[model samples]
Target: GLLGRYTPLDNGTDTVDEVALLELMKKTGYSMMQENGQRKYGPPPGWDGPPPPRGSEVFVGKIPRDMYEDELVPVFEKAGYIYTFRLMMEFSGENRGYAFVMYTKREMAQKAIHMLDNYEIRPGKYIGVCVSLDNCRLFVGSLPKDKNKEEIMEEMKKVTEGVVDVIVYPSATDKNRNRGFAFVEYESHKAAAMARRKLIPGNTLLWGLNIQVDWAEPEKDVDEETMQRVRVLYVRNLMLSTSEETLQEAFSCVRPGSVERVKKLTDYAFVHYRSRQDALDALRLMNGTLIDGALVTVSLAKPAAGRDGGGATWRHGGGGGGDGLFLFQRENGGVEGRRCTTPGPPGLLPAYGAQRVFPLPPGTPLSPSSLQALKPYQMSSYVSLLEHFCYQHSWSPPDYYLFSTPGPKILLIFKVVLVSTQNSYLPDKLCALVEDARELAAQHALWSLGTHTHTHTLGPRYAHTPTLTLWGQGTHTPAPTLELKFVQELSIILFD
Candidate 1:
């Protein structure tokens, strides 16, 4: 009877009648609280009930702005018991066109979604209903570099409600500055959602800069099952000059053969150990330790879900970058105590055996019978020649790109480009079943360089070439056109 007197306008922009709204709230036994631009109604002042269960909340959107709870509640309650109703409002008293309704039981929320989704509330207005994910974190971007945690929290509280905590990542280059963005955690999902709406582009400015806002990507939790298989550690904040050999030597001190492999990226590296215990020991000793005059942070590397079982890419935190470690294990689905011998160059010496195997894509069909490994003589003749030339010329390392073509028979394409000179070369001979793509590609590169009868002077230094590709070859696979360029300047001679 009381709700009948407070009918909303069709245009939905009418100023709210606070006195009538208060009377309706009291009559309906609903408590009310108002914040910056939202009104929450639930848990009546003198009443008590159990809190809404998890998964019992439904998000209601596309509401008619003029509509109020008195008109909206009856329709929502038709499916279940109401625990709380939060209507996003504006200073002008019109509704913000959306609301969240939590039911006492999860089944009621599900039923509400099934029954009222896309239900028409008026002649031309249909409201959308769905499960609320209940995320309580927000990603705040474009923050002033100089702002600290304390300064940011104070500023956020002035414009929004339910300010709880701000999480800022320190810049790798400058400890005093943040990484230009921070994560803000709210006490509840409702508060975070309200802050997101208020902080959206063009709505507000923080520290004289227009900042960006969105829900923070939740970090995946690592479980005991994952920890059981972890033999890798993600190491970050490394110096760009750090080499794989340097890191391998540093990590090997835990025990003989403790460090299986080390992959050094731009400013970080991944260390694979022979056992999980070895990984644990390395992490404890290496984390927060100084290497090459830089403090590195080490953490357990968790395998990303849904990646290939052969090689699962792992990440440290939810975000990518130095924290992410890409690991490729053997196709046999084993990461411990397995070793394969890789022969050196052909024609130069005897085949070397009993050496450790490098990582490869899983289920790859590169068996011993299918392909012959490279010989020692051939490996040294070509690779050593180029290495000597590079050393003599004071040239940077050559860039290589490796990728596989899609098919029943995968084609490995290896492309190498020397940064200094512009000359391109293709391999005259093809080899198959090599364990390391990089080594095989280097042989092909040297063969292509040797076939050239004429010598050209090295040129000026240029920008780094695009990534080069190296592919594994089959016995019957035809050789693709390959280009090798040396762009740097030096006096060079070629002999047939």
Candidate 2:
């Protein structure tokens, strides 16, 4: 009577009788209604073969409500031999608008996704298709808090196949008890799927309680490409007053000089390392660790913007001088400036030198207006201002000036030794700024700026003294004007 009342092709007009439905399923090769109310048709009416291998299943969604297996199975058959077709159904005898189709081969399932995804099942009605994830873990909730891992594993083995391990978390409130849920890892997706089918609501109970069972969600937030074997760590959430030297000392605990450089920002920093393993170890050990009473987060540094191949090009807007901005290309450890329309101070011209240059740190503000704020005729005031600017930005004062050939246009060469409080390296930002201007000079034959390690027996010398030398061409204006232009160019390099 149920077979007569409800047929496989029947479209949701009548409810099928359970007795006749079972007889109909027997004849049509469909399994009995599952605990979740889904009807599974494996080896669909033809061959008695084992289930398809993994990776052969595709999740199909967006089925019309009235659609049934008679309509869905044929469309999927166009892909390949059907190994299993599971259509989830409601109690009202309607399909649940989504299904899983397993092909005899993985290639066929992939083909089904390409050909039938968005395939029209009805007018203006299409289905979405994709490969189903083969999850090997099942989440079992509402477990007895008294049950330990070993006891749960023992009980689970009595009801399911392939029970590899049971992971239970301890309760935060009470350490003596579990959190009432545990993840059961299975040997394969098939084992977990079968276990889930058996453990659905009203089918089986654990410890006389109906527990929730579902596939454990897989992790998707690992940024593999950006973090692949990176040696630089980007750290954030630092204390505002944290210094680069402090960061270097903290990060170099792995080994002496393990940390190559530490670029400290307001409340963040980038730590560079020579070895990838050292960076990984540091990230694992130092992330969320307290520094200056604040916990810092450390992760692999992503490649910054404007990086092309192995070089970087930084373009800035017109600086405070109203002079057009300069373009600096960083390649081969030198920053070469180009298209700088800012002319040298009045009566100063180009006498190029082919030397490499470096840029100052990003976001370092070197004010051109500071030099302009002073009167060129006031030598004492201008020199004091220069020393003050360097001191304010934690730089050593400019003390060494090598004057060459007294004339109306004197070649004034001055060197400022970059003072490192504790280490042999110069600040990378300063290196970039000086090198950029040096290369710009080389391009136009205007002036020269270069870095060198030198010792002065007559004065205090650093262990590794890297000096910024500006070789000025003959300028009619007082040397202060030329000095102002040098500072302005450096400002442009460090401004943006």
Best candidate (score: TM-score): 1
Candidate 1 — which residues are off by over 4 angstroms?
Answer: 1-132, 148-165, 170-177, 221-224, 249-256, 306-311, 316-496
Misplaced by over 4 Å in model 2 are 1-36, 45-48, 139-162, 165-183, 187-215, 219-496
Please report the candidate that would top lDDT against the real structure: 1
Cα RMSDs of all predictions? 19.1, 26.5
The local lDDT score (0 to 100) that residue 145 gets in candidate 1 is 76
- Model 1 weakest lDDT span, ten residues long: 487-496
lDDT of 2 by residue, 1-496 (tens): 2222234544643444455545545656655334354667666666666777777888777778777666677789899988878776676677666777888887788789779977888999978776665567776766778888899999999999999998775443444576566789898866887897898656998998777565554322212333464677777666767888999999997889898766664556667788888988898889988888776778776543233211133322121111122333345544444332222332222222222224679899886565435553432332344445455557543322111122224232222222222111112111123223322222221111124334332111111122223222232333332332233223222211
- Model 1 lDDT, residue 61, Cα: 76
* lDDT by residue (tens digit), candidate 1, 387-414: 5555556764444433332222433323
